[model samples]
Target: MVFKTPLLDKPAPGWKQDLPGPNESPSIEPYPPVLSNPPNHVDNVYLELARATVRTRGVGVWLTFLMFSLAIVALLSLIAYILKEGTMPPPIPGIALLMGFIAALWGGVFIWRMDVDPPRDEPIRFNRFRRKVYVYRFHHHGLRPFSRTAWGVRAEVYDWDNLRAEACSVYGPMGSGGLIETVTLAVVKPGTHQVIDRFHFAHEIQQGEMYWAMAQLFMQQGPQALPAFPRPPRDWNNEDVSFNLARRLAPKVQWPAEIDLESRTAS
Candidate 1:
């Protein structure tokens, strides 16, 4: 099934759904607790803000990119050859062509989705200094099917106290027998369990929890309390063709000025 989640102010699902359990801020103790060591955090995105700026590209992006790109080319080629022969599509080839076209359409959509110019990362910044989190997101229209929802870029700010972490898992498309799990920071209404807003945090749970822990530690005790990132950050600034093409065609990380400033300040 395709993955879908309520966006900005859409009422969140009630707790009774079969979805994964709500991973509260530190699962009855989330690993790498507020007092624990950082679990090899690496986000050139930004550890610099008493902040955690994270990427929107989740798991399976690269793999989906490859699969869909190939499907578009191969499927289109098959359609062309069949058309060139001027014969009606046979039973197997006909269904195959239909499936291929759909897959190709989605593949093209994936390419359009990711390959973008700078600032497309939709970076979510958690500023411990200001006790706030600023989300840079492109809110798509949820009324349509999930894949079609790429609407507009907007920045949102929230008080840090109301945010809760939740894990959502969805099956891979075309029955690929794979599971994709992600962590999202849900914004609950002040003093209530009602979630009002949310944004993607980490592609995987453990890493996201670690980032969450580090950010929490920074907010409460300052940056000195957390361990250093395992290595220099890795970002799209390098010369790799994929990176360069992404910069040329689509996504990169650049936070809004107001949020950026407040997130980094001590006062």
Candidate 2:
């Protein structure tokens, strides 16, 4: 049975030629066991329940916040010192005031750009037995203070068979790393190539293919056929002290009870 996506009904456009092109992927489904790298960014995998889940990759939100936080604190402290002292130290008083004002403005911009109330991670669940996939997507406009649009989670379910893989190449900042890429799984309309909705799958191109292959293998032959993951299944609650601290600030994963129950159990 094909489960309908809750997000959209229209065909997802913007895939014109020369933009995220190469129409189809060679690593599409019925993928063989030739893939290497077992799985990456996976938070949990249940062999018994035939379920595996992974979060969005490369989101080092904690580090980013830390860097910005320290800078903001320093800038504020400097501004406070200037205000308290009421004396000019380096350049002219006007120049010092101007510099302090600029620093304050930069600090405010940093706060605006920082992801303050982010959902810990965007988790995507694959239920092999049910031949279904669930995405816990957190939608936000920008940081809370600057953004007028409220942020929230948008969960969706899809039939595993209707999904197709699209390898999207991304250029690095200053075009540093040549051929940097990721995999985006497009949900086609039942039997047609028309895309209805999509979600990111993996980070690296080769590893993404391997990860998709692992998903295919698990969905087809169960977890027994899959190789062991390099790292053990992550326990979010008992993660590293630093990550746990970061998690405290981010919103918890609140999957719908019905979807959560259905995804983890064979009905």
Candidate 3:
């Protein structure tokens, strides 16, 4: 028997022509969180924000630690009882000790995992004076004594001039019967439009303002001039808009060319 590949549908010759031109504008509609009522947090000074996931994870870590601590305490009590009660079997103490050890080991592993796999949605800090952006992730262990150093915090820095920003809309079905819209901010490499970081804001009151505030800082453009959500040329894909904006706004950096075969041979 011979195997054959299935044919795929092909676009018409005029498909490109049929698409809306760059100049054409779609029915741009403005959604909630009006420009007038920007979030109070949108100030000219340094800005710090964290994704919702990070907050949720922090709560989860504390809860896990509490549960583990209780288990450890109960195991220790069991071991003590086994030792004092002469009526109990000889192996009771040993079994309790073994279980306690296992619980302790589990607790250690949990702390290690939390430290190494810190939440992805860490806080983002933008310092205007320093011209830098910093993202911070925190790790904590309940067993260890509390100390600032023991927080296991880590930070990553990005230069202000090298950063690019993009906004995209996400839609999903809501249980209430209507669709819910979410806005996402993407920090990207200038010119190339490669995404380095991203975060989301629920598309509700005040969130839009927060997005614009950050975008203004990243673009180094005035807040008024920053691109608004549901950007123009609605026919274009969000990815296309992001790339085009990056190319237009970012300074074009000329990368060094690859060495030729002749140069390699001579070397």
- Of the candidates shown, which would achieve the greatest lDDT relative to the real structure? 2
Among all windows of 10 consecutive residues in model 3, the one with the lowest summed lDDT is: 13-22
Per-residue CA lDDT of candidate 2, range 1-267, in tens?
111332223323322111121122324332324443234233234222111122332244445555566656656665776798885345665465556555555554433333435455556767766778777765554334345356657778888877876555655564455554666677878757677777666565565665666666666666675665544445443455464443555556677899878877777
Per-residue CA lDDT of model 1 for 205-264, tens digit only, reads 565556566666655655565665433433533425454434454444566687667655
Model 3 backbone overlap count:
0
Q: lDDT of all predictions, in order shown?
A: 0.52, 0.53, 0.40
lDDT of 2: 0.53
Instruction: Give the candidate order by descending lDDT.
Output: 2, 1, 3
**Candidate 3 — which pairs collide?**
none
**Full candidate order by TM-score, most accurate first:** 1, 2, 3
Model 1, residue 166: displacement in angstroms?
Answer: 1.4
For all candidates, the clash counts are 10, 0, 0
Superposed model 2: Cα runs more than 4 Å off = 1-116, 142-150, 174-179, 243-248
Task: Write the residue-wise lDDT of candidate 3 on 171-265 in tens digits.
Answer: 44546455343433444566544556654432432453344344444335323433343322221112232423222232221212331111112
lDDT of 3 at 109: 54
Q: State each model's C-alpha RMSD to the native.
A: 7.9, 8.3, 16.8
